[model samples]
Target: MMSDCGLDYIELLQQEVDRTSAKLLYLRNEEEPEEAPPPRHTPHTCSAPRRLAISPGLGGKPLTPPFTENLRRLLFGRTVRVFNFDWRKSFFHFREPNSELSYALQVDQGGARAVQMVIQARIIKHLLFSQQGGSEGRSLLSLTELGPPEQQGALAAALSDSLWLAGQEESATVTMVTEDDSPKPPSEYRLDLLTEKMHTFVFNRKEELSSFLLDHIHCFQEEGGHGVVLFLYSLVCSRTIDRIREDLDSSTAHLLQRRLGNFVCSQALLNLLLTGRATPHVCNGTQAPGGGAAPLDPPLQGVLSRGDIGYLHWSREQMDRDRLLQVGSMLKTPRFPVWLCCINSTYSVLFSLTRSLLSDWRTEHQFQLFYYNGQNSQNSTARLTIDTHSHHWEAPSVDPGVDLEKRFPSLEMTIRTKWEGASINWGGIPPFY
Candidate 1:
């Protein structure tokens, strides 16, 4: 037994050493490859030949950054402990309520604003769960739940009143009242009674509650941006549901229902903002152009005005072409268009997503109001053709004799990258419920 244990320990140590060595090599730039020039191809008269050069260094390579180290540190570092709650349930529960809030905001806004409007709503509620140490199965703890549509008219009234009262001292008062109102407070309010109860529960400890709430609020604000706030809320709710089930054997179907509701509400709000109508509130709302309300949403309408719908339309086209190319590449078939389209779409999507997410209000206004309508006098076009005559290649037989484990070693690598990116993106946002 002793010898076996010793062997296991040695193996573990060796593994750690290998991992560290690999990471150090990467950090020191020893694992990166040099760049190469593009292959010669038939070029269109209006465009330069497309280059197929590899990037020069580690950072130059797209989607190949060293994320493991960052992830490891984030996971192991000291983290703020927010109470685990079922996300899906919270989402579904809040969906209708938030949708109502959105409807109210629209009615209150009254279709007169020159600029786009945004209304943020938050609510808190109590939750109950099992506590193994205190009871046979569980117990109840007073916690806070943040969501929208605390009541029917409260959110809309607050948002509308705030908008109308902007640029005045009353705006701050309105904001505070909206943020601090107890959505479902008990009928009776006795400050002295609550104070005495709080004193009695001193032994239970409560300092962490304030800190956790602060942390959550800070994280939420920091993650605020176009679509980020909604996305973060969704992520938190999903993760909470997952954590609860895995850790507590809790049934999360109810939670999932709630999460769906929240998602619907968010979608409805987004739709309302985009389109000038409340069609998104309908259960069978149409999303396609011309089928639903004219012009769809504001952002999309803005895109159309600029004639840059080509950006997104081109992206979708490229994605389809890339999918076909990947299959062709695997089958060793002719894949010139597929490969080119895949690379081009990948670059374009990267640029567009980044720009859309990071561009500020000023930049967006400038683009939409001025540059979008202007004509590009110096229009240019380019094309390229792959010359595979000199390249020797043979298609492998369709027999299932290939060693997939060795041939597709990078499959796991690709999956890990995608998962890591998603996690990082979601991590910055606030929890839904």
Candidate 2:
């Protein structure tokens, strides 16, 4: 027994050494390169390309996003107990084997959900865009497809890329917040760039905040750096509140709202993360009133153009009681076959391997769709078989007592937003919300 215990201890020590060595090497090799040329597709590597690169080493020292206690209270509702988050203890931390799967983000928390949501978005981008062939590149990967470390690296790349993009948004200066002369409660604190006491980091035209972001990818990725909050600050600083207000009129588009002692992102805020603009509605371009003597209720701001990622929203409660707002084609059919979904007010993701699932109707007949809810509770990626042509329930004569709206699952409703009359099959697995 003593000899066996000794052997096990030695093996464990060796494993630890190997893991540490591998991590150190990965960190050094993946440092962001300057004006990186388009990366060569190596399924083995996760290097950032030119658009995604954040050049390091040129700057005097590594930059961490200057988040302070007061600022954390103001934005995130509370500060993390540690100055830097411990990856081992938190659900937010990415680990081996589990990292490659559809990892869950503790969404019902403070603004931190933004980090998880954005990470998921980036992973989706990496998986969809990273496929090999001309025809095959249009495909998407399932939860278990990529290796653990590669997916983790992809998360690093994606988080950095999002921060860089947020910085690149057209704003006059990058806004940084500090305590005002007259202190206020955390609940009352807000981001107001025009206020006299605010501190602004001036990154004038052409120069972007991403220059700082590229170097500090780990700050957001590994250290629990409140990346999404930091990027939100960068974006708001760039666009300014005045411009954001105009994007959705002065009245609507509230970026954050109070929820269960913490705050969560509003629709406009979610759109801003997905796209650069904080338009409230999910439609194509700005929808204005028809040329008639109608009251000027302000034009609706929406997705100005197609983005690399897309969005979808549906609520059983919203559909049953409130005004039924339909999702437009712009978000319903994106340039890619992936979407960040809000179903019954909970966030989940739905994607397809086939790119032509939208543009060409013929491809929709019987294609597979996979769903990821970011919960460890999910037994498997919900593989849904959509039969657009074979669905017989489209006719009104089917049954009035069936409560048509409740009869269809929310996921099916979400898919029907893109594929209008399609029927969904859960493949013998009982349908879940």
Candidate 3:
């Protein structure tokens, strides 16, 4: 009953995994972890090519693109298309707000892991930039030094504080799988970690958590440690399990749902990543389902508080059927100008350097907004000009009888979330979305 083509595909995929894995193993052994990175890094200058933003590895070196590319190629192989914006391609710095490489570190993919990675990026940003005199990049630059008791304590305290804030004032919960030995990740190259022993941890106080994490930092950062996932678990723990449960409604029982042999994030998980409340919907606040029937148990949760970054969602599938959820103002109007946009279920980031881009209406007439699709093809940042009050978006050239919502490019609709009735001029750069 088995077809030869299917068998060939499996065999080829397995060979790729093995080849990539071997290549990485060789690199890890032969290559001494790069010198402890400079404690302080200058902001990405337009002069140098910006590497994909990936977190440091077990070796304490900021992961480079080739290495992360190999990671995704090894783990997902050809099964899933790899993107530069995927968590695997980025690195984490202890504190570097003025860094360009940091921009690509967020997850632009579809799974629960993607959501957690996004939340993890926010947590790291809060730790590094939010606090004025917190741990410097030097503190995290060389994880090899975590063995030292002093450094271990310092790292722990810093992580604890960040996670505390990540909880949004509520306690957090950290859930992780326990591994006994070996540096390599589990079967299926860390993709099939279903049977690993899982553990949930709570630190009575933030300081008390310093030792365990410092001692086991390798378990989180090592080549096979599932470092990102471990980091997410720690953040969740700081928020506590109870809150995570409350963040979900009857429909979504967990943060991730498996599909097509891979895992993807739920809206609740994404809301948690954005606002920390894990509200499932995109609306401003909790709302009962339509039809005015008796409200369902555990009323639908929307974003309660705005997070550091905002989210914009536009689904053509949902819009075509007139099922688009009107994302509320709270999400549309965030505390910051950066937004993680979900266009047709794929994630992309749109941001402006001007902090007042959202609050100040005067600056909206003509401005530059940068976009990154996370695809490997992109070598430089794509810049787009948004011209509001320029063209008459109100009057379309198309027949009045046609459905307008389905006519416009999805990106225009997403941007309109903030500008209301602005026209988008691609500035001669063909709009991809």
Identify the candidate with maximal TM-score.
2
Q: Which regions of candidate 1 fall more than 4 Å away from where they truly are?
A: 1-278, 281-433
Candidate 3: regions farther than 4 A off: 1-102, 106-113, 116-162, 169-223, 292-298, 398-407
* Ranked by lDDT, top first: 2, 3, 1
Say which prediction, candidate 1 or candidate 3, comes out ahead on TM-score: 3
TM-score of each: 0.17, 0.65, 0.60
- lDDT: which candidate is best? 2
Worst 10 residues of 2 by lDDT: 41-50
C-alpha root-mean-square deviation, candidate 1 = 28.7
Q: After superposition, how far is residue 301 of candidate 1 from its true place, in Å?
A: 15
True lDDT of residue 356, candidate 1: 33
Whole-model Cα lDDT per candidate? 0.20, 0.53, 0.52
Output the TM-score of candidate 3. 0.60
lDDT of 2 by residue, 1-433 (tens): 5797898787556545534543443243234232343222111111111222223323222212233333443333333211111111122344334444533333323345554665676566665664345234453334455554555556545544444455454333333222232222233222121121223455443334435434444434432233344445555645555556656654353566555433566667777677666778776787774455268666767777776567787788888785456666777676777788877767777878777766787787789988877665665668888887876646664568877667777878877867768888888987875
